[model samples]
Target: MAFVALSEAEKVYIVHGVQEDLRMDGRGCEDYRCVEVETDVVSNTSGSARVKLGHTDILVGVKAEMGTPKLEKPNEGYLEFFVDCSANAAPEFEGRGGDDLGTEIANTLYRIFNNKSSIDLKSLCINPREHCWILYVDVLLLECGGNLFDAISIAVKAALFNTRIPRVRVLEDEEGLKDIELSDDPYDCIQLSVENVPCIVTLCKIGYRHVVDATLQEEACSLASLLVSVTSKGVVTCMRKAGKGSLDPESIFEMMEVRLVLGRCLDLAGSAGCLLPPWSHCGNSPH
Candidate 1:
């Protein structure tokens, strides 16, 4: 995200407020903006979710396809993350304009999921190296408000939780020919275990203090921000520094502590309150 210009006086005011544990929006240092999450919002995908955090809007779709397993992990399936910054979000994203930003965000997601702790790829496999389910997690940015990473991660987690992959069995005869058979009941399916899926929390360093989930206006007043990905169990998976200005090592350590604390809150609230599985909701899309 590009930085916006803020007057010197405004910057000083924001910094002073942060030193007092307050912000322009009245949220404390660790408080997050209101989050709205809806599952199965799109019809074509096997699972989908839309999350709106303040002004940042993100949509995630999961499509399961059968494909050959990778050589390194022949017994496991994997996830492909694609981030599309749609023109609908902003006129700046028209045509291929958003390609650069999209690629950057997609790469971050790939790195975050590189560890086995993030997702159970082996469970997605149907038949060792012969057959496996590849989940294509496509994320669409509907708005470019500040804190895009955090919103996108939340949406992705919700969509995966909503995914229901149908049960398929392969039948082999004495001749060694294989036949794929779908489950007798269409409703019988498997759900991905997203208990370890991580959520990205962005902390913008404004003035002398930092804040989480900063809006675009607030982001404009800040110099740099830290991106931290944390799992539902409060485990930190990835961390990176974003934006223009540099951050001190001591401040970075302080921000990490705050990120972990806030991450736990978001995980508990989002999973229990907003991230409902499709079966639990009777397959009805949360419009």
Candidate 2:
């Protein structure tokens, strides 16, 4: 994660703001920064999206390729995640320095969709145990402001929703040989149902209250943070803890209350013809 150094007095100022449910940027404790989303922004990809939250910029591209299913789950396909933090994104990302953060983010993304229900993996299967479509989700950290996980998550969900995998058919010959056929029509492709795809919401525990989308300054004041992966249906697919500070059961429970807010917000966005996963819901409290 990218970080910014802050003095003792500066930390106290941000902490005081969070405790009063007012942040330096005028957002509430549970409010997120205004997020900008752009979809289908890249060529030669099955799907692509760019998300900007505060100073954070993330670009995600999903590529669909045919490969054999895994041995453990022969009838289902899987998603592969790769994260790249360019040197220009942050000073700490120079050369191989950002490898650790990239690997950590990629691993977290894997845990987010490590189940069958997250995606219809069965739909990608052309022949049971023989072949399936593998989705390669590549993430590029164009810039690092704060709340890296949340920004990347939103970009990934948007890309997955935009993915269009070519439909394939199996042709079995008389000699018990099977061949795969691809659709000639460009538009003859299948899209994954993103209704169950999860989005990550990072809440930083600052002072006595928790704040969503904590900027670098706010992060310097935070004692701990929670990463919540929630679906549009309010399901928690994964949870992760960050920072050296420890959180009690009460704090964890309080943070979990935020899980539903993201789901409801997404529902409203869909109804309003918005394709992006807007993480903030104004006038809502997570208490």
Candidate with top lDDT is 2
Candidate 1 global lDDT: 0.81
What TM-score does model 1 achieve against the real structure? 0.90
Instruction: State each model's CA lDDT, in order.
Output: 0.81, 0.83
Model 1, 1-287: lDDT tens digits are 53456788887787888889787777776677777788888899988989887778888999999999999999999999888888878777898989989998999999889999888998888888788999999999988777898888888888888898989988999999998887878589988878888889898898778888787778878779999999867789999988889999988988887776667655653454374344212322122
**Shift of residue 276 alpha carbon in model 1, Å:** 12
Model 1 stretches astray by more than 4 angstroms:
2-9, 273-287
**Ten-residue stretch with the least lDDT total in model 2:** 267-276
31-55: candidate 2 lDDT, tens digit per residue:
7666677778899999998888789
